[model samples]
Target: MSKLSISQAAKLKGVSTQTLRRWEAEGKLIPERTAGGHRRYDLAQLMGTKSELSFTVGYARVSSHDQKEDLLRQVEVIELFCASNGWQVEIIQDIGSGLNYSKKGLKRLINLITDHRVERLVLTHKDRLLRFGSELIFSLCEIFGTEVVIINRTEDSFFEEDLAEDVLEIITVFSARLYGSRSHKNKQLLQELKNVARQL
Candidate 1:
């Protein structure tokens, strides 16, 4: 009846440390407290057939670096949501275009899903996960036995604004690449043209 620390227990159970913590919060596996109030799991608990606990992960993202405040808000909301549910949550975040799948945080989340380490995934919005192909990820989660939770299901004015901004960013990139760099005078002329188009 050897007692193992959280890390050791997680290793024995083939799960992440976060998963073990979540299980503890969910009352799936109760660990004994050391004199110092540290958690110590009994090895037998890790090998128990009755414990079915898994980790819950929260993901947040903003499409632009300038939206740092929005990113923080998303994280705060996720933390509050998880806390309210009495869930121990691991939060993953990204500061990149939703169309970019190479973001480190996004990649890590996907890897966790693929490894079946995630029992549940919470996102502030579907677009926060990806601008497109989000259904593919959802399908993968289904196959991996991970549940998806979106904090916001209805589209809002903010979503429309973000979509328009993304469209403008794409247009700017293609416009620059196709027309090459413009002289200051030409740039001013283009701005004036944009203003005229807006007025129309």
Candidate 2:
């Protein structure tokens, strides 16, 4: 029944100290406080509650249909990584711009997290989740006690290309919304944008 400080407990749990603090606030993982108001976690108690989570979720995304191979590669990588860790994973793949929030797979993943059915979320990279607003999702995960694992924290080789695509998507969506999707102005604007994107 060894007791550990918040940092030590967070390290042992593979989560951040901030996450531990949030969990404490949410009454999910309360710790005993010393006279000095330092939180102390019981190792035995932590270990005993380890099996409560449902399963790990592996999420893979590509910005377009042309990148389906890349999506598959991400899935394979996630599966192998989770297997090495003995994590039972369910792979969810998405084909859409990272800036698109309405993707079916992304919505499903959000639902699972919000429902507290996911123990962990495995990704090849953080941006694979979204070109923007990924942090909001991560914050949601923390609130729901879902651990996020990004296997590759390094800069992505295709980052520039993906960012360009997401930028194009944003422009296209906004152009259509402003000019009317079926209007000639919208079509011309989209074509011009695509041409410029291709030239770069």
Best by TM-score: 2
Against the reference, the lDDT scores of all candidates come to: 0.75, 0.82
- How much lDDT does candidate 2 score? 0.82
**For residues 1-200, what per-residue lDDT tens digits would candidate 2 score against the true structure?**
49999988876775556657766786778899999999999998866545354568999999888888898899999999987876778999998888899999999999998987777899999899888899999999989888889999998766877877887877776774757657887678778887777555
lDDT of 1 at 5: 88
Query: Model 1 off-target regions past 4 Å?
Result: 1-54, 181-200
RMSD of 2: 4.8
- Distance (Å) between predicted and true CA of 196, model 1? 10
Clashing pairs in 2: none
**Cα lDDT of model 1 by residue, 116-179, tens digit:** 7787799888888888888988998888767788888876325754665556555565566445
Worst 10 residues of 2 by lDDT: 46-55
Q: In candidate 1, which residue pairs clash?
A: none
